[model samples]
Target: MSDIDRSPKAPDLYVHYCEHQGCDNWGSWGKSPSAAVATRWWCFEHFPHKSFDRNRR
Candidate 1:
């Protein structure tokens, strides 16, 4: 058998899919300034709205 037979199939990661459910918009790495939140892949619609801080003007 050839070495190719032993190789594992690569996963089809729709890697840029938005973190939000039911939302298929293209996504990218997202983050919040607050230390309490973890960074994750988010779409353009949600990326600017993720916030942990309550105090705002």
Candidate 2:
């Protein structure tokens, strides 16, 4: 069997806008795996004029 058939299928991955309510910005972001969980993720946004501390949460 090919790699696609050997491994369990993963659903399509998509970058959704940050779930921070009231902010409907279609974020052009990417997903990163959370350090605490293998199945969890963090979405990073590209805000050219702003600074963010990813480790602060």
Q: Which candidate number would show the highest TM-score if scored against the true structure?
A: 1
Model 1 CA deviation exceeding 4 Å by range: 1-14, 32-38, 48-57
lDDT of 2 by residue, 1-57 (tens): 566565457788875564445666655553334667433222343442232345434
lDDT of each: 0.66, 0.46
Instruction: Give per-residue CA lDDT, model 1, range 1-57, as digits (tens).
Output: 776685477878766677888988877856655578765667877764626334322
Worst 10 residues of 1 by lDDT: 48-57
After superposing all C-alphas onto the true structure, candidate 1 shows an RMSD in angstroms of 5.1
What is candidate 1's CA lDDT for residue 17? Answer: 71
For model 2, what is the alpha-carbon lDDT of residue 43? 37
